[model samples]
Target: MPSHAPDRFDEVPGDLSRVGAHRAPRPRHHRVRAFAWAAL
Candidate 1:
């Protein structure tokens, strides 16, 4: 057998949604709390 170079991940598009199933949107409780604290 001979050595072979693996395919590069950079060939994929920067936008993952275009190539794979995208995650569902969800509430960001942490960001809300951070903003609330910053406001104080």
Candidate 2:
């Protein structure tokens, strides 16, 4: 799962675009979630 985090960080921007205009919230949420996990 640790390996997956950086992968997701790399993907998030591309995903934000593909996910459309509503992408803002989701990315922010995931970023926060990712940071929280990383902090642990």
Candidate 3:
């Protein structure tokens, strides 16, 4: 059971770092594009 604990703990931070690094730029671009289209 102790071996399982470290594996489970590693998953949460791993997912967060990936999302922060890779996903952070995309939604921001989409948001700006939507605003631009709405203004037009």
Candidate 4:
């Protein structure tokens, strides 16, 4: 897969790309959260 978009976001040019929950993940939440988010 490839992203045509550059590292720079036109709308948020001042902010870096956010690739997370944007916060520390909840403790031991992945077992449930992963399946829910991933539809697994």
Candidate 5:
């Protein structure tokens, strides 16, 4: 029996285009914490 599967490469471009338009928001304190964690 043959199975049908959707192509992932076709779906990825549309998903990335949609998300690329939006800018992510981050709090100042959160940014500071993230940097501190990375330094450790």
Candidate 6:
């Protein structure tokens, strides 16, 4: 019989709320110009 121990288990949460939570949105002009310049 195979037995597993609960005490040896660990729980991890996917928490993105704490990361980059205060970053400002990218400017629309920069995004559009970047692609246009790259395509040339």
Please list the C-alpha lDDT of all candidates, in the order they appear: 0.63, 0.61, 0.58, 0.56, 0.61, 0.58
Kindly list the per-residue Cα lDDT of model 5 for residues 1-40, writing each as its tens digit. 9977878543445433345435344556988899999999
- Tens digits of per-residue lDDT for model 2, 1-40: 3554365444556534456346555445788899899999
Give a tens-digit lDDT track for model 6, residues 1-40: 9987766224334552433444344567987899899999
- lDDT, residue 37, model 2: 100
Worst 10 residues of 5 by lDDT: 14-23
Give me the candidate number with maximum lDDT. Answer: 1
Mark the regions of model 1 whose C-alpha exceeds 4 Å error after superposition.
1-28
Global fold similarity of model 4 (TM-score) = 0.26
> What residue pairs are clashing in model 1?
none
Candidate 2's C-alpha runs over 4 A off are 1-16, 19-28
Tell me how many clashing residue pairs each candidate has.
Answer: 0, 0, 0, 0, 0, 0
Could you tell me which residue pairs clash in candidate 2? none
Q: Which numbered prediction scores highest in TM-score against the true structure?
A: 2
What's the TM-score of each model vs. the native? 0.31, 0.32, 0.31, 0.26, 0.31, 0.30
Q: How many residue pairs of model 2 clash at the backbone?
A: 0
Roughly what TM-score does model 1 have, to 2 decimal places?
Answer: 0.31
**Residue 25, model 3: Cα distance from true site in angstroms:** 10
Off by over 4 Å in 6: 1-28
Higher-ranked by TM-score: 4 or 5: 5
Candidate 3 per-residue C-alpha lDDT over 1-40 given as tens digits, one digit per residue, 9 for 90 to 100: 3554466435444344355336443555788899899999
Q: By the lDDT metric, which is better: model 1 or model 3? A: 1
Q: Between 1 and 5, whose lDDT is larger? A: 1
| Predicted candidate 4 versus true structure: per-residue lDDT over 1-40, tens digit per residue | 8768666434453354544435333458667888898895
Collision count of model 1: 0
